[model samples]
Target: MKLRISHETTYGYDQPIRNLVQSLRLTPSIFEGQKTHDWRIEIPGGIRGPGFRDGAGDWVEGWTLRGPAEEVSVRISGHVETRDTAGVLRGHREMIHPLAYLRSTHATAPDKALREAAMSLETTGDHLELAHGLSALIAAAIAFRPGVTETHTTAAEAFALGQGVCQDHAHALITVARLRELPARYVSGYLHSTADGQAHEAAHAWAEIHVGNLGWVGFDAANRCCPDERYVRLGSGLDASDAAPIRGVAMGTGAERLAIRVQVEEMEQ
Candidate 1:
């Protein structure tokens, strides 16, 4: 399948910002499951900085905006050909060892409930099965409800509430996967489907666990399935903040509001 994506983020500030520095990980991944074409980024009146690939094989670019800027817009458009490899990440070059992901982040910290949930799963020594079970458990435990959690909401918090969006489900699953010693990381990407009645945000998130033989395989607890052709992976990190598509700081005390639009549509192959 071929997918076209359009994403625009606009920030409106009550007071003019002195400067804005943004680091973007909006580019698609290079792997057997997907190939990107005609990708572009536009930031009017902004200076583009150096771009490079990070340790986890995701592309990163820097942008800077000058003073007295009341509003800023960052736009991205791209096309990607995607294929399903049964959720296995293949042909992607990366330097980080899988063990690095075993380290837990604040957002993914497992609590007593999460630990107990992981401990209750039937263990057959199959990491893949265990991973699937972990995802299933999260989906069953947490109902997908937006606006109930914040960006910094932790896995333990969401599990306690039993209600959250996709990020919470992914975070919960990641926490439990780590409890079982399965290396897990957060994945930020796009999903082209909304028919499942799950959280289908234009920007989607999931978890990937490293099995002994299959390597990193995606599991989206919110959707209750592995990522497939409809998925366009962007990047991965210890948690959502680390894997954020846009990370920026405005050098002023001005309060800011944001407007974002995203569309992921299927195209004729």
Candidate 2:
């Protein structure tokens, strides 16, 4: 399957920003089941991007921009060819060790509810089954509500509220898996299908557990299924904050307006 992705993010500010530096993980690397045919990142000032392997062995691009500016927009456009391997990504060759994924960040803590959930699934020995079971549990536990939680919501908070979007679900799953000594990573990308009318324009999130023999297998708790060809993996990290498509700081701020538009469609063979 071939996919074409076009993502544009715009920010309007009441006052101009003096300087800004952004860390972007928007680029995807080719593994056993996927291949990147063409990719490009476009910014207004025409900035250059540097590539490096992160702690989870995922490819990352840290790009920066500076100067007095009123508005900024970052666009990532790419095409990728993917093969469905039944959710298995084999022979992932980055040097980042598996244990590095367990280190927790401020945004992705498990708290009581997630710990309790992990306690229930204590059979052990099989990470894939455990991850699958966890996905079903998360999907059944929370109702998908658009305005229930924001990007900064915690896992325990989301679990208690019983409602959230895909990011909340993935955060909860990653938190719990790390508690159980399993290396889990947060995945940010586009899910090709959705009940919402804009199936082609959606931002999706999921969790991937590192199983020794199987490598990293993705389990989308929101959809309650392993990722197939419909999933386009853009970036991954310990939590959403690390893997966010755009993260930066602005100098001046009175009030700010933000808008995001993403489109992911299957291309003709």
Clash total of candidate 2:
0
Best prediction by lDDT: 1
Clashing pairs in 1: none
**Global CA lDDT of candidate 2, please?**
0.78
Model 1: lDDT equals 0.93
RMSD in Å for candidate 2, one decimal?
2.2
lDDT of 1 by residue, 197-256 (tens): 343446889999999889999999987899999899999999999999999999998899
Poorest 10 consecutive residues by lDDT, candidate 2: 192-201
- The true-versus-predicted C-alpha distance at residue 133 of model 2, in Å, is 1.2
lDDT of 2 by residue, 1-269 (tens): 78888888887788887766777777775576667766878778746667687655566666666767778888888887877777776656666777889988876777777788887875667777777777787888777787989989988888889999988888888887888788888888877775343474677888888877777888888877787788777778788888787777767765778989888888999
What lDDT would each prediction earn against the true structure? 0.93, 0.78
Residue-level lDDT for 264 in candidate 1 = 89
